[model samples]
Target: MKSILLSVIIIIIISSSCVNKNNSVQDKEEIIAVLNQQQKDWSNNDLESFMDGYWKSDSLYFYSGKKLKSGWENTLNSYLKNYPDKSYSGTLKFTIAKISAITPDSYFVMGEYNLTREVGNATGTFMIIFKRIDGEWKIIADSSC
Candidate 1:
Protein backbone atom coordinates (compact mmCIF):
# COMPACT_ATOMS: atom_id res chain seq x y z
CA MET A 1 0.00 0.00 0.00
CA LYS A 2 2.82 2.41 0.89
CA SER A 3 4.57 1.68 -2.40
CA ILE A 4 1.38 2.35 -4.36
CA LEU A 5 0.88 5.66 -2.55
CA LEU A 6 4.48 6.64 -3.30
CA SER A 7 4.04 5.82 -6.97
CA VAL A 8 0.94 7.96 -7.17
CA ILE A 9 2.76 10.88 -5.61
CA ILE A 10 5.58 10.54 -8.11
CA ILE A 11 3.13 10.44 -11.02
CA ILE A 12 1.31 13.50 -9.73
CA ILE A 13 4.53 15.49 -9.43
CA ILE A 14 5.69 14.46 -12.88
CA SER A 15 2.34 15.35 -14.40
CA SER A 16 2.34 18.77 -12.73
CA SER A 17 5.85 19.56 -13.90
CA CYS A 18 4.97 18.63 -17.45
CA VAL A 19 1.86 20.76 -17.36
CA ASN A 20 3.81 23.75 -16.05
CA LYS A 21 6.36 23.50 -18.87
CA ASN A 22 3.72 23.57 -21.60
CA ASN A 23 1.32 25.97 -19.88
CA SER A 24 2.64 28.79 -22.02
CA VAL A 25 1.00 27.20 -25.03
CA GLN A 26 -2.41 27.81 -23.55
CA ASP A 27 -1.49 31.38 -22.64
CA LYS A 28 -0.22 32.07 -26.15
CA GLU A 29 -3.47 30.81 -27.58
CA GLU A 30 -5.49 33.00 -25.25
CA ILE A 31 -3.42 36.05 -26.16
CA ILE A 32 -3.80 35.30 -29.84
CA ALA A 33 -7.54 35.00 -29.41
CA VAL A 34 -7.65 38.42 -27.76
CA LEU A 35 -5.59 39.96 -30.56
CA ASN A 36 -7.82 38.37 -33.15
CA GLN A 37 -10.90 39.83 -31.51
CA GLN A 38 -9.28 43.24 -31.29
CA GLN A 39 -8.41 43.12 -34.97
CA LYS A 40 -11.99 42.27 -35.83
CA ASP A 41 -13.25 45.05 -33.59
CA TRP A 42 -10.95 47.64 -35.14
CA SER A 43 -11.79 46.54 -38.66
CA ASN A 44 -15.44 47.08 -37.81
CA ASN A 45 -14.64 50.58 -36.48
CA ASP A 46 -15.58 49.47 -33.01
CA LEU A 47 -13.08 51.38 -30.98
CA GLU A 48 -14.89 50.67 -27.77
CA SER A 49 -14.74 46.96 -28.40
CA PHE A 50 -11.06 47.17 -29.25
CA MET A 51 -10.45 48.96 -26.00
CA ASP A 52 -12.05 46.05 -24.23
CA GLY A 53 -8.74 44.23 -24.54
CA TYR A 54 -7.00 46.92 -22.55
CA TRP A 55 -6.83 47.05 -18.78
CA LYS A 56 -9.51 49.51 -17.78
CA SER A 57 -7.54 51.22 -15.07
CA ASP A 58 -5.72 54.44 -14.35
CA SER A 59 -2.43 52.55 -14.57
CA LEU A 60 -2.88 51.66 -18.22
CA TYR A 61 -0.24 53.28 -20.45
CA PHE A 62 -0.05 54.08 -24.14
CA TYR A 63 2.64 55.79 -26.22
CA SER A 64 2.57 56.71 -29.89
CA GLY A 65 3.94 59.38 -32.20
CA LYS A 66 5.10 62.10 -29.82
CA LYS A 67 2.23 61.38 -27.49
CA LEU A 68 2.14 59.62 -24.16
CA LYS A 69 -1.14 58.66 -22.60
CA SER A 70 -1.78 57.19 -19.16
CA GLY A 71 -5.01 55.57 -18.03
CA TRP A 72 -7.54 53.63 -20.09
CA GLU A 73 -9.83 56.62 -20.60
CA ASN A 74 -6.94 58.75 -21.81
CA THR A 75 -5.91 56.08 -24.28
CA LEU A 76 -9.47 55.77 -25.57
CA ASN A 77 -9.67 59.53 -25.92
CA SER A 78 -6.50 59.56 -27.94
CA TYR A 79 -7.85 56.92 -30.30
CA LEU A 80 -11.13 58.80 -30.66
CA LYS A 81 -9.37 62.10 -31.33
CA ASN A 82 -6.92 60.72 -33.84
CA TYR A 83 -9.11 58.25 -35.65
CA PRO A 84 -12.38 60.22 -35.39
CA ASP A 85 -14.25 57.92 -37.75
CA LYS A 86 -13.91 54.77 -39.81
CA SER A 87 -12.39 56.77 -42.65
CA TYR A 88 -9.60 58.00 -40.36
CA SER A 89 -9.52 55.01 -38.07
CA GLY A 90 -9.12 52.77 -41.06
CA THR A 91 -8.81 48.99 -40.87
CA LEU A 92 -6.15 47.76 -38.45
CA LYS A 93 -4.15 44.66 -39.23
CA PHE A 94 -1.44 43.24 -37.00
CA THR A 95 1.41 41.02 -38.10
CA ILE A 96 2.90 39.63 -34.96
CA ALA A 97 6.67 39.41 -34.97
CA LYS A 98 7.05 37.72 -31.63
CA ILE A 99 5.36 37.07 -28.34
CA SER A 100 7.64 36.54 -25.33
CA ALA A 101 6.76 35.66 -21.81
CA ILE A 102 7.79 38.19 -19.20
CA THR A 103 6.28 36.24 -16.33
CA PRO A 104 3.69 33.58 -15.76
CA ASP A 105 0.89 36.11 -16.07
CA SER A 106 2.58 38.64 -18.34
CA TYR A 107 3.89 38.79 -21.89
CA PHE A 108 5.32 41.36 -24.30
CA VAL A 109 4.20 41.21 -27.92
CA MET A 110 6.14 42.82 -30.74
CA GLY A 111 4.42 43.29 -34.04
CA GLU A 112 3.73 45.52 -37.01
CA TYR A 113 0.43 47.28 -37.57
CA ASN A 114 -0.94 48.35 -40.95
CA LEU A 115 -3.80 50.78 -41.34
CA THR A 116 -5.77 50.88 -44.58
CA ARG A 117 -7.62 54.13 -45.14
CA GLU A 118 -8.69 56.43 -47.91
CA VAL A 119 -6.61 59.22 -46.43
CA GLY A 120 -3.43 57.12 -46.44
CA ASN A 121 -1.94 53.79 -45.49
CA ALA A 122 0.15 53.78 -42.33
CA THR A 123 2.42 51.09 -40.98
CA GLY A 124 4.49 50.87 -37.82
CA THR A 125 5.97 48.54 -35.24
CA PHE A 126 4.53 48.17 -31.80
CA MET A 127 5.45 46.58 -28.48
CA ILE A 128 2.66 45.92 -26.06
CA ILE A 129 2.70 44.28 -22.66
CA PHE A 130 -0.21 42.13 -21.60
CA LYS A 131 -0.86 41.06 -18.04
CA ARG A 132 -3.41 38.70 -16.62
CA ILE A 133 -5.73 40.58 -14.31
CA ASP A 134 -8.98 39.64 -12.69
CA GLY A 135 -8.98 36.28 -14.47
CA GLU A 136 -8.57 37.96 -17.87
CA TRP A 137 -5.66 39.10 -19.99
CA LYS A 138 -5.47 42.82 -20.67
CA ILE A 139 -2.99 45.16 -22.31
CA ILE A 140 -1.24 47.07 -19.55
CA ALA A 141 1.14 49.05 -21.71
CA ASP A 142 1.45 49.88 -25.40
CA SER A 143 4.15 51.65 -27.39
CA SER A 144 3.50 52.14 -31.09
CA CYS A 145 5.76 54.02 -33.41
Candidate 2:
Protein backbone atom coordinates (compact mmCIF):
# COMPACT_ATOMS: atom_id res chain seq x y z
CA MET A 1 0.00 0.00 0.00
CA LYS A 2 2.83 2.43 0.86
CA SER A 3 4.57 1.74 -2.43
CA ILE A 4 1.40 2.27 -4.43
CA LEU A 5 0.66 5.57 -2.71
CA LEU A 6 4.17 6.85 -3.35
CA SER A 7 3.93 5.97 -7.03
CA VAL A 8 0.64 7.78 -7.37
CA ILE A 9 2.02 10.92 -5.70
CA ILE A 10 5.03 10.92 -7.98
CA ILE A 11 2.83 10.53 -11.03
CA ILE A 12 0.68 13.40 -9.93
CA ILE A 13 3.68 15.63 -9.48
CA ILE A 14 4.99 14.79 -12.91
CA SER A 15 1.63 15.52 -14.50
CA SER A 16 1.37 18.84 -12.75
CA SER A 17 4.82 19.83 -13.91
CA CYS A 18 3.86 19.00 -17.50
CA VAL A 19 0.77 21.16 -17.21
CA ASN A 20 2.86 24.09 -15.99
CA LYS A 21 5.26 23.72 -18.87
CA ASN A 22 2.38 23.68 -21.34
CA ASN A 23 0.93 26.80 -19.78
CA SER A 24 4.26 28.56 -20.12
CA VAL A 25 4.39 27.68 -23.80
CA GLN A 26 0.90 29.03 -24.33
CA ASP A 27 1.85 32.29 -22.67
CA LYS A 28 4.86 32.65 -24.93
CA GLU A 29 2.66 32.04 -27.95
CA GLU A 30 0.32 34.81 -26.89
CA ILE A 31 3.20 37.25 -26.68
CA ILE A 32 4.42 36.19 -30.09
CA ALA A 33 0.96 36.77 -31.53
CA VAL A 34 0.98 40.31 -30.24
CA LEU A 35 4.34 40.99 -31.83
CA ASN A 36 3.17 39.46 -35.11
CA GLN A 37 0.17 41.77 -35.21
CA GLN A 38 2.46 44.70 -34.58
CA GLN A 39 4.49 43.83 -37.64
CA LYS A 40 1.39 43.48 -39.77
CA ASP A 41 0.06 46.83 -38.62
CA TRP A 42 3.32 48.52 -39.48
CA SER A 43 3.38 46.91 -42.92
CA ASN A 44 -0.15 48.14 -43.50
CA ASN A 45 0.98 51.67 -42.68
CA ASP A 46 -1.22 51.91 -39.62
CA LEU A 47 1.07 53.59 -37.15
CA GLU A 48 -1.74 53.89 -34.68
CA SER A 49 -2.29 50.18 -34.59
CA PHE A 50 1.40 49.38 -34.63
CA MET A 51 1.82 51.50 -31.55
CA ASP A 52 -0.62 49.21 -29.77
CA GLY A 53 2.14 46.66 -29.20
CA TYR A 54 4.13 49.15 -27.13
CA TRP A 55 3.57 50.01 -23.50
CA LYS A 56 1.47 53.17 -23.55
CA SER A 57 3.11 54.60 -20.47
CA ASP A 58 5.88 57.17 -20.37
CA SER A 59 8.30 54.46 -19.29
CA LEU A 60 8.50 53.05 -22.77
CA TYR A 61 11.97 53.34 -24.33
CA PHE A 62 13.20 52.80 -27.85
CA TYR A 63 16.55 53.11 -29.57
CA SER A 64 17.04 53.51 -33.29
CA GLY A 65 20.44 53.94 -34.88
CA LYS A 66 22.20 56.25 -32.42
CA LYS A 67 19.17 58.07 -30.98
CA LEU A 68 17.24 57.04 -27.90
CA LYS A 69 13.53 57.89 -27.93
CA SER A 70 11.13 57.87 -25.03
CA GLY A 71 7.35 58.05 -24.64
CA TRP A 72 4.75 56.31 -26.78
CA GLU A 73 3.48 59.38 -28.56
CA ASN A 74 6.95 60.52 -29.44
CA THR A 75 7.71 57.15 -30.96
CA LEU A 76 4.52 57.17 -32.96
CA ASN A 77 5.10 60.69 -34.22
CA SER A 78 8.62 59.82 -35.21
CA TYR A 79 7.42 56.77 -37.10
CA LEU A 80 4.84 58.82 -38.94
CA LYS A 81 7.35 61.44 -39.90
CA ASN A 82 9.86 58.90 -41.13
CA TYR A 83 7.44 56.55 -42.83
CA PRO A 84 4.79 59.04 -43.95
CA ASP A 85 2.43 56.60 -45.76
CA LYS A 86 2.16 53.15 -47.25
CA SER A 87 4.69 53.94 -49.92
CA TYR A 88 7.33 54.53 -47.31
CA SER A 89 6.08 51.90 -44.89
CA GLY A 90 6.01 49.28 -47.59
CA THR A 91 5.24 45.61 -46.98
CA LEU A 92 7.12 44.45 -43.94
CA LYS A 93 8.30 40.92 -43.24
CA PHE A 94 9.76 39.85 -39.93
CA THR A 95 11.70 36.66 -39.32
CA ILE A 96 11.90 35.97 -35.64
CA ALA A 97 15.28 34.49 -34.81
CA LYS A 98 14.93 34.18 -31.06
CA ILE A 99 12.14 34.54 -28.53
CA SER A 100 12.47 33.63 -24.90
CA ALA A 101 10.22 34.10 -21.93
CA ILE A 102 12.61 35.39 -19.31
CA THR A 103 10.03 35.35 -16.55
CA PRO A 104 6.30 34.99 -16.06
CA ASP A 105 5.92 38.68 -16.90
CA SER A 106 8.90 39.35 -19.13
CA TYR A 107 10.14 38.25 -22.54
CA PHE A 108 13.00 38.99 -24.91
CA VAL A 109 12.80 38.62 -28.67
CA MET A 110 15.16 39.16 -31.57
CA GLY A 111 14.11 39.31 -35.19
CA GLU A 112 15.04 40.60 -38.61
CA TYR A 113 12.79 42.93 -40.58
CA ASN A 114 12.58 43.64 -44.29
CA LEU A 115 10.56 46.27 -46.09
CA THR A 116 9.52 45.78 -49.69
CA ARG A 117 8.35 48.51 -52.03
CA GLU A 118 8.80 49.88 -55.49
CA VAL A 119 11.11 52.65 -54.41
CA GLY A 120 13.56 50.79 -52.19
CA ASN A 121 14.07 48.23 -49.46
CA ALA A 122 15.50 48.33 -45.97
CA THR A 123 16.48 45.50 -43.71
CA GLY A 124 17.51 45.44 -40.08
CA THR A 125 17.41 43.45 -36.89
CA PHE A 126 15.32 44.25 -33.84
CA MET A 127 15.54 43.27 -30.19
CA ILE A 128 12.59 43.86 -27.93
CA ILE A 129 11.93 43.43 -24.26
CA PHE A 130 8.31 42.89 -23.30
CA LYS A 131 6.61 43.03 -19.95
CA ARG A 132 3.17 41.80 -19.07
CA ILE A 133 0.85 44.41 -17.64
CA ASP A 134 -2.84 43.96 -16.91
CA GLY A 135 -2.60 40.53 -18.50
CA GLU A 136 -1.26 41.99 -21.74
CA TRP A 137 2.28 41.88 -23.09
CA LYS A 138 3.68 45.26 -24.11
CA ILE A 139 7.06 46.28 -25.33
CA ILE A 140 8.84 48.12 -22.55
CA ALA A 141 12.14 48.64 -24.32
CA ASP A 142 13.04 48.04 -27.92
CA SER A 143 16.22 48.51 -29.94
CA SER A 144 17.10 48.06 -33.59
CA CYS A 145 20.28 46.90 -35.31
Candidate 3:
Protein backbone atom coordinates (compact mmCIF):
# COMPACT_ATOMS: atom_id res chain seq x y z
CA MET A 1 0.00 0.00 0.00
CA LYS A 2 2.81 2.44 0.91
CA SER A 3 4.75 1.70 -2.29
CA ILE A 4 1.66 2.26 -4.40
CA LEU A 5 0.94 5.62 -2.76
CA LEU A 6 4.56 6.76 -3.30
CA SER A 7 4.48 5.74 -6.94
CA VAL A 8 1.25 7.65 -7.48
CA ILE A 9 2.67 10.75 -5.81
CA ILE A 10 5.77 10.65 -8.00
CA ILE A 11 3.63 10.32 -11.11
CA ILE A 12 1.55 13.32 -10.09
CA ILE A 13 4.66 15.42 -9.53
CA ILE A 14 6.11 14.45 -12.88
CA SER A 15 2.85 15.21 -14.65
CA SER A 16 2.58 18.61 -13.05
CA SER A 17 6.13 19.45 -14.06
CA CYS A 18 5.46 18.46 -17.63
CA VAL A 19 2.38 20.64 -17.75
CA ASN A 20 4.32 23.59 -16.43
CA LYS A 21 7.02 23.12 -19.04
CA ASN A 22 4.46 23.01 -21.82
CA ASN A 23 2.82 26.16 -20.56
CA SER A 24 6.20 27.90 -20.48
CA VAL A 25 6.82 27.03 -24.11
CA GLN A 26 3.40 28.28 -25.11
CA ASP A 27 3.98 31.51 -23.23
CA LYS A 28 7.27 32.08 -25.04
CA GLU A 29 5.65 31.54 -28.41
CA GLU A 30 2.84 33.93 -27.59
CA ILE A 31 5.30 36.60 -26.48
CA ILE A 32 7.30 36.22 -29.66
CA ALA A 33 4.13 36.57 -31.72
CA VAL A 34 3.34 39.85 -29.99
CA LEU A 35 6.79 41.20 -30.79
CA ASN A 36 6.48 40.12 -34.40
CA GLN A 37 3.14 41.86 -34.71
CA GLN A 38 4.63 45.04 -33.32
CA GLN A 39 7.35 44.95 -35.92
CA LYS A 40 4.82 44.42 -38.66
CA ASP A 41 2.70 47.29 -37.43
CA TRP A 42 5.69 49.59 -37.32
CA SER A 43 6.64 48.67 -40.84
CA ASN A 44 3.12 49.53 -41.91
CA ASN A 45 3.39 52.95 -40.22
CA ASP A 46 0.68 52.00 -37.78
CA LEU A 47 2.09 53.34 -34.54
CA GLU A 48 -1.14 52.86 -32.66
CA SER A 49 -1.22 49.17 -33.49
CA PHE A 50 2.45 48.77 -32.71
CA MET A 51 1.90 50.25 -29.28
CA ASP A 52 -0.57 47.47 -28.55
CA GLY A 53 2.30 45.26 -27.47
CA TYR A 54 3.09 47.64 -24.62
CA TRP A 55 1.27 47.62 -21.32
CA LYS A 56 -1.45 50.23 -21.33
CA SER A 57 -0.80 51.43 -17.83
CA ASP A 58 0.32 54.58 -16.11
CA SER A 59 3.27 52.69 -14.71
CA LEU A 60 4.60 51.61 -18.06
CA TYR A 61 8.22 52.66 -18.48
CA PHE A 62 10.28 53.33 -21.58
CA TYR A 63 13.90 54.37 -21.79
CA SER A 64 15.44 55.70 -24.96
CA GLY A 65 18.63 57.56 -25.58
CA LYS A 66 19.32 59.41 -22.32
CA LYS A 67 15.73 60.01 -21.33
CA LEU A 68 13.34 57.92 -19.28
CA LYS A 69 9.67 58.09 -20.05
CA SER A 70 6.81 56.96 -17.88
CA GLY A 71 3.21 56.05 -18.66
CA TRP A 72 1.73 54.77 -21.90
CA GLU A 73 0.39 58.14 -22.86
CA ASN A 74 3.77 59.75 -22.51
CA THR A 75 5.41 57.09 -24.58
CA LEU A 76 2.80 57.46 -27.29
CA ASN A 77 3.24 61.19 -27.27
CA SER A 78 6.98 60.84 -27.61
CA TYR A 79 6.61 58.49 -30.53
CA LEU A 80 4.26 60.88 -32.21
CA LYS A 81 6.65 63.75 -31.75
CA ASN A 82 9.59 61.78 -33.04
CA TYR A 83 7.89 60.10 -35.95
CA PRO A 84 5.12 62.39 -37.02
CA ASP A 85 4.81 61.01 -40.56
CA LYS A 86 5.53 58.00 -42.69
CA SER A 87 8.80 59.41 -43.94
CA TYR A 88 10.07 59.87 -40.40
CA SER A 89 8.67 56.56 -39.19
CA GLY A 90 10.37 54.70 -42.00
CA THR A 91 10.34 50.88 -42.22
CA LEU A 92 11.07 48.99 -39.04
CA LYS A 93 12.70 45.59 -38.60
CA PHE A 94 13.57 43.57 -35.54
CA THR A 95 16.05 40.77 -34.98
CA ILE A 96 15.56 38.93 -31.74
CA ALA A 97 18.88 38.09 -30.14
CA LYS A 98 17.70 36.38 -26.99
CA ILE A 99 14.52 35.65 -25.14
CA SER A 100 14.29 33.97 -21.74
CA ALA A 101 11.72 33.49 -19.05
CA ILE A 102 12.42 35.56 -15.97
CA THR A 103 9.56 33.94 -14.07
CA PRO A 104 6.49 31.93 -14.90
CA ASP A 105 4.70 35.11 -15.87
CA SER A 106 7.59 37.36 -16.92
CA TYR A 107 10.06 37.28 -19.80
CA PHE A 108 13.14 39.18 -20.91
CA VAL A 109 13.81 39.91 -24.57
CA MET A 110 16.87 41.40 -26.22
CA GLY A 111 16.74 42.42 -29.86
CA GLU A 112 18.09 44.71 -32.51
CA TYR A 113 15.91 47.24 -34.28
CA ASN A 114 16.70 48.79 -37.64
CA LEU A 115 14.88 51.65 -39.29
CA THR A 116 15.43 52.20 -42.99
CA ARG A 117 14.30 55.54 -44.28
CA GLU A 118 14.86 57.72 -47.33
CA VAL A 119 16.49 60.29 -45.06
CA GLY A 120 18.82 57.97 -43.20
CA ASN A 121 19.03 54.59 -41.48
CA ALA A 122 19.30 53.96 -37.79
CA THR A 123 20.04 50.76 -35.89
CA GLY A 124 20.02 50.03 -32.21
CA THR A 125 19.67 47.32 -29.62
CA PHE A 126 16.78 47.02 -27.23
CA MET A 127 15.90 45.09 -24.12
CA ILE A 128 12.33 44.69 -22.98
CA ILE A 129 10.72 43.09 -20.01
CA PHE A 130 7.39 41.45 -20.72
CA LYS A 131 4.81 40.37 -18.21
CA ARG A 132 1.72 38.27 -18.59
CA ILE A 133 -1.07 40.70 -17.90
CA ASP A 134 -4.75 39.94 -18.22
CA GLY A 135 -3.88 36.77 -20.15
CA GLU A 136 -1.75 38.71 -22.63
CA TRP A 137 1.96 39.35 -22.88
CA LYS A 138 2.72 43.07 -22.70
CA ILE A 139 5.92 45.00 -22.50
CA ILE A 140 6.19 46.42 -18.99
CA ALA A 141 9.58 48.02 -19.47
CA ASP A 142 11.59 48.93 -22.53
CA SER A 143 15.18 50.06 -22.79
CA SER A 144 16.26 50.95 -26.28
CA CYS A 145 19.50 52.44 -27.41
Candidate 4:
Protein backbone atom coordinates (compact mmCIF):
# COMPACT_ATOMS: atom_id res chain seq x y z
CA MET A 1 0.00 0.00 0.00
CA LYS A 2 2.83 2.43 0.92
CA SER A 3 4.67 1.55 -2.30
CA ILE A 4 1.57 2.31 -4.34
CA LEU A 5 1.14 5.70 -2.63
CA LEU A 6 4.77 6.60 -3.27
CA SER A 7 4.44 5.74 -6.92
CA VAL A 8 1.35 7.90 -7.23
CA ILE A 9 3.17 10.84 -5.60
CA ILE A 10 6.11 10.46 -7.97
CA ILE A 11 3.84 10.40 -10.97
CA ILE A 12 2.05 13.54 -9.81
CA ILE A 13 5.32 15.39 -9.31
CA ILE A 14 6.57 14.43 -12.74
CA SER A 15 3.35 15.52 -14.38
CA SER A 16 3.37 18.83 -12.50
CA SER A 17 6.94 19.48 -13.65
CA CYS A 18 6.02 18.86 -17.24
CA VAL A 19 3.04 21.20 -17.04
CA ASN A 20 5.16 23.96 -15.51
CA LYS A 21 7.77 23.56 -18.24
CA ASN A 22 5.18 23.83 -20.95
CA ASN A 23 3.60 26.88 -19.34
CA SER A 24 6.97 28.58 -19.08
CA VAL A 25 7.68 28.00 -22.76
CA GLN A 26 4.28 29.34 -23.70
CA ASP A 27 4.80 32.44 -21.57
CA LYS A 28 8.13 33.16 -23.21
CA GLU A 29 6.69 32.79 -26.66
CA GLU A 30 3.83 35.14 -25.86
CA ILE A 31 6.24 37.75 -24.57
CA ILE A 32 8.40 37.46 -27.68
CA ALA A 33 5.37 37.80 -29.90
CA VAL A 34 4.37 41.00 -28.13
CA LEU A 35 7.84 42.41 -28.71
CA ASN A 36 7.70 41.47 -32.36
CA GLN A 37 4.35 43.19 -32.74
CA GLN A 38 5.70 46.33 -31.11
CA GLN A 39 8.57 46.36 -33.60
CA LYS A 40 6.14 46.07 -36.45
CA ASP A 41 3.96 48.84 -35.07
CA TRP A 42 6.93 51.17 -34.73
CA SER A 43 8.12 50.39 -38.23
CA ASN A 44 4.68 51.34 -39.47
CA ASN A 45 4.94 54.70 -37.65
CA ASP A 46 2.00 53.84 -35.48
CA LEU A 47 2.94 55.16 -32.06
CA GLU A 48 -0.48 54.44 -30.62
CA SER A 49 -0.20 50.80 -31.62
CA PHE A 50 3.35 50.63 -30.30
CA MET A 51 2.24 52.00 -26.94
CA ASP A 52 -0.15 49.08 -26.58
CA GLY A 53 2.79 47.01 -25.38
CA TYR A 54 3.11 49.16 -22.27
CA TRP A 55 0.94 49.17 -19.19
CA LYS A 56 -1.72 51.79 -19.55
CA SER A 57 -1.60 53.04 -16.01
CA ASP A 58 -0.22 55.88 -14.00
CA SER A 59 1.93 53.41 -12.06
CA LEU A 60 3.90 52.55 -15.17
CA TYR A 61 7.57 53.53 -14.86
CA PHE A 62 10.08 54.66 -17.43
CA TYR A 63 13.64 55.87 -16.91
CA SER A 64 16.00 57.08 -19.59
CA GLY A 65 18.92 59.45 -19.75
CA LYS A 66 18.46 61.94 -16.89
CA LYS A 67 14.69 61.64 -16.83
CA LEU A 68 12.48 59.31 -14.87
CA LYS A 69 8.75 59.32 -15.43
CA SER A 70 5.77 57.49 -14.07
CA GLY A 71 2.47 57.12 -15.97
CA TRP A 72 1.80 55.83 -19.47
CA GLU A 73 0.59 59.14 -20.85
CA ASN A 74 3.76 60.88 -19.79
CA THR A 75 5.83 58.28 -21.53
CA LEU A 76 3.76 58.58 -24.70
CA ASN A 77 4.03 62.34 -24.67
CA SER A 78 7.79 62.08 -24.35
CA TYR A 79 7.95 59.75 -27.30
CA LEU A 80 5.86 62.18 -29.32
CA LYS A 81 8.01 65.11 -28.29
CA ASN A 82 11.26 63.37 -29.11
CA TYR A 83 10.23 61.56 -32.21
CA PRO A 84 7.56 63.94 -33.55
CA ASP A 85 7.47 62.29 -36.97
CA LYS A 86 8.72 59.31 -38.96
CA SER A 87 12.02 60.96 -39.81
CA TYR A 88 12.65 61.57 -36.12
CA SER A 89 11.17 58.31 -34.91
CA GLY A 90 12.87 56.19 -37.57
CA THR A 91 12.55 52.45 -37.98
CA LEU A 92 12.94 50.58 -34.70
CA LYS A 93 14.70 47.27 -34.44
CA PHE A 94 15.15 45.31 -31.24
CA THR A 95 17.76 42.65 -30.56
CA ILE A 96 16.67 40.85 -27.45
CA ALA A 97 19.58 39.67 -25.33
CA LYS A 98 17.63 37.87 -22.66
CA ILE A 99 14.19 37.32 -21.19
CA SER A 100 14.04 35.93 -17.66
CA ALA A 101 11.03 35.00 -15.60
CA ILE A 102 10.55 36.85 -12.33
CA THR A 103 7.37 35.03 -11.45
CA PRO A 104 4.72 33.05 -13.24
CA ASP A 105 3.09 36.36 -14.09
CA SER A 106 6.13 38.58 -14.59
CA TYR A 107 9.33 38.77 -16.64
CA PHE A 108 12.32 40.99 -17.30
CA VAL A 109 13.79 41.49 -20.75
CA MET A 110 17.17 42.95 -21.65
CA GLY A 111 17.76 44.07 -25.20
CA GLU A 112 19.34 46.54 -27.55
CA TYR A 113 17.39 48.95 -29.78
CA ASN A 114 18.50 50.62 -32.97
CA LEU A 115 16.73 53.40 -34.86
CA THR A 116 17.56 53.96 -38.50
CA ARG A 117 16.36 57.33 -39.75
CA GLU A 118 17.08 60.25 -42.02
CA VAL A 119 18.13 62.31 -39.01
CA GLY A 120 20.79 59.79 -37.91
CA ASN A 121 21.03 56.35 -36.35
CA ALA A 122 20.85 55.79 -32.60
CA THR A 123 21.57 52.66 -30.61
CA GLY A 124 20.84 51.93 -26.98
CA THR A 125 20.35 49.16 -24.46
CA PHE A 126 17.29 48.67 -22.32
CA MET A 127 15.82 46.46 -19.62
CA ILE A 128 12.05 46.25 -19.26
CA ILE A 129 9.79 44.47 -16.82
CA PHE A 130 6.58 42.86 -18.03
CA LYS A 131 3.73 41.68 -15.88
CA ARG A 132 0.69 39.68 -16.83
CA ILE A 133 -2.32 41.80 -15.98
CA ASP A 134 -5.88 41.14 -17.06
CA GLY A 135 -4.62 38.08 -18.91
CA GLU A 136 -2.32 40.27 -21.01
CA TRP A 137 1.42 40.93 -20.75
CA LYS A 138 2.27 44.59 -20.46
CA ILE A 139 5.52 46.38 -19.77
CA ILE A 140 5.32 47.79 -16.25
CA ALA A 141 8.76 49.30 -15.99
CA ASP A 142 11.57 50.25 -18.33
CA SER A 143 15.09 51.61 -18.10
CA SER A 144 16.94 52.56 -21.27
CA CYS A 145 20.05 54.44 -22.13
Tens-digit lDDT string for candidate 3 (1-145): 9999999999999999999999988988999899889888888888989999999999999999899999999998899889888788899988999989899999999999999986788899999999999899999999999
Identify the candidate with maximal lDDT: 4
Q: TM-score for all predictions?
A: 0.88, 0.88, 0.93, 0.96
Q: Which residue pairs collide in model 1, if any?
A: none
Residue pairs with colliding backbones in model 3 are none
After TM-score superposition, the amount by which residue 14's alpha carbon in candidate 2 deviates from its true location, in angstroms, is 2.4
- lDDT (C-alpha, whole model) for all candidates: 0.93, 0.90, 0.93, 0.94
Q: What is the Å distance of residue 19 in model 4 from its true position?
A: 0.9
* Candidate closer to the true structure by TM-score (higher is better), 1 or 4: 4
Native-referenced Cα lDDT, model 1: 0.93
Q: Best candidate per TM-score, number?
A: 4
Report the lDDT tens digits of candidate 1 across residue range 34-124. Answer: 9999999988889999999999999999998887889999998888888888898788899999999999999999999999997899999
Model 2 pairs whose backbones collide: none
| Candidate 2 TM-score versus the reference | 0.88
C-alpha RMSD for every candidate: 2.6, 2.0, 1.3, 0.9
Question: How well is each residue in 42-80 modelled by candidate 4, as lDDT tens digits?
Answer: 878888899999999999999998789999999999888
| Model 4 superposed RMSD (Cα) | 0.9
Candidate 3 local accuracy as lDDT?
A: 0.93
